[model samples]
Target: MRIGELARRCNVSTRALRYYEEQQLLTPGRHPNGYRDYPESAVETVRRIRTLLDAGFNADTIRIVLPCLNGDDVDMCPQVAAAIRDTLHGIDEQLRDLETKRGRITALLAGRQL
Candidate 1:
């Protein structure tokens, strides 16, 4: 399919698809007329990319992790595991920071000093 069809099927803008291509996240073949020709699987790929982005994975992380996520294999690569672990650690730190901020707000509400 062409880029427009792929974007419509995926519910993403053509600009987003082009950005994905620029980031090396999605690759589309070029037609003789200079149009982009995406494979049928590109639809599913864009869906997965959206899911990952919604989960807070940046393009760099998505680029790193998508291949590991692609196959029917149940196991992931060590690098994938490491990246996940790192992301989890970042989440944990953010949670802790939020908790600390909540505590400070609670103290302020109680008329106590920080």
Candidate 2:
């Protein structure tokens, strides 16, 4: 299929598909007419990319993890495991910071000067 068909099937914009290609995540071949020709499997690959991006995985991380993905499960190599652990830790730290800010705001709203 072509780029437009891939975008339509994946429900993502052509720009996004191009971005994915630029990120080296999606590899579509070039036609003689200079159009991009994507394999049929690109549909599912795009879906997986979206899912990983939604899960807060960056393009680089997704690139590393893509080949390790098997259906709904990730193969969880050492590097991937470490990356996930780091992401989880970062998220935890952000949650703690947000909780602290929430408490401060609540106190201020309640007229407590602290």
Candidate 3:
């Protein structure tokens, strides 16, 4: 299928698909007319990319983790495990900061001055 069809099927914009290509997250073949030709599996790949992005993973992290998500034996790589662990740690720190902000807001709403 072409890029438009893939975008329609994936419910994402063509710009997003192009961005994915630029990020090296998606690889579509090129037609003689200079159009992108995507395989059927591109739909599922896009879905997965959306899911990861929704979960706060950046394109680079997603690139690193895609092979693992695709059921490869990446667990054997200690560096991959470390990178994932670091990402999780960062997420936990962000959650803690958000919780602190929420508590301050709650206190302010409760007639307490910050």
Best by lDDT: 2
- Report lDDT (CA) for all predictions: 0.86, 0.92, 0.86
Residues 1-114, model 1: lDDT tens digits: 998899889899999999999999999999999999898888888988898788777888788888877554424688877877777788899999999999999999999999
Our tally of clashes for model 3 stands at 0
Clashes of each: 0, 0, 0
> Which regions of candidate 3 fall more than 4 Å away from where they truly are?
71-76
Best by TM-score: 2
Question: Looking at model 2, which ten-residue stretch has the lowest summed lDDT?
Answer: 82-91
**Sort by TM-score, best first: what order?**
2, 3, 1
lDDT of 3 at 104: 96
Candidate 2 vs candidate 3, lDDT winner: 2
- Candidate 3: which pairs clash? none
Candidate 1 ranges beyond 4 A from true positions: 71-74
Alpha-carbon RMSD, candidate 1? 2.0
Cα TM-score per model: 0.84, 0.91, 0.88
TM-score of 2: 0.91
Candidate 2, residues 1-114, lDDT tens digits: the string is: 999999889999999999999999999999999999999999999999999899888898889889899998989889989887877787899899999999999999999987
Give the lDDT of residue 12 in candidate 3: 97
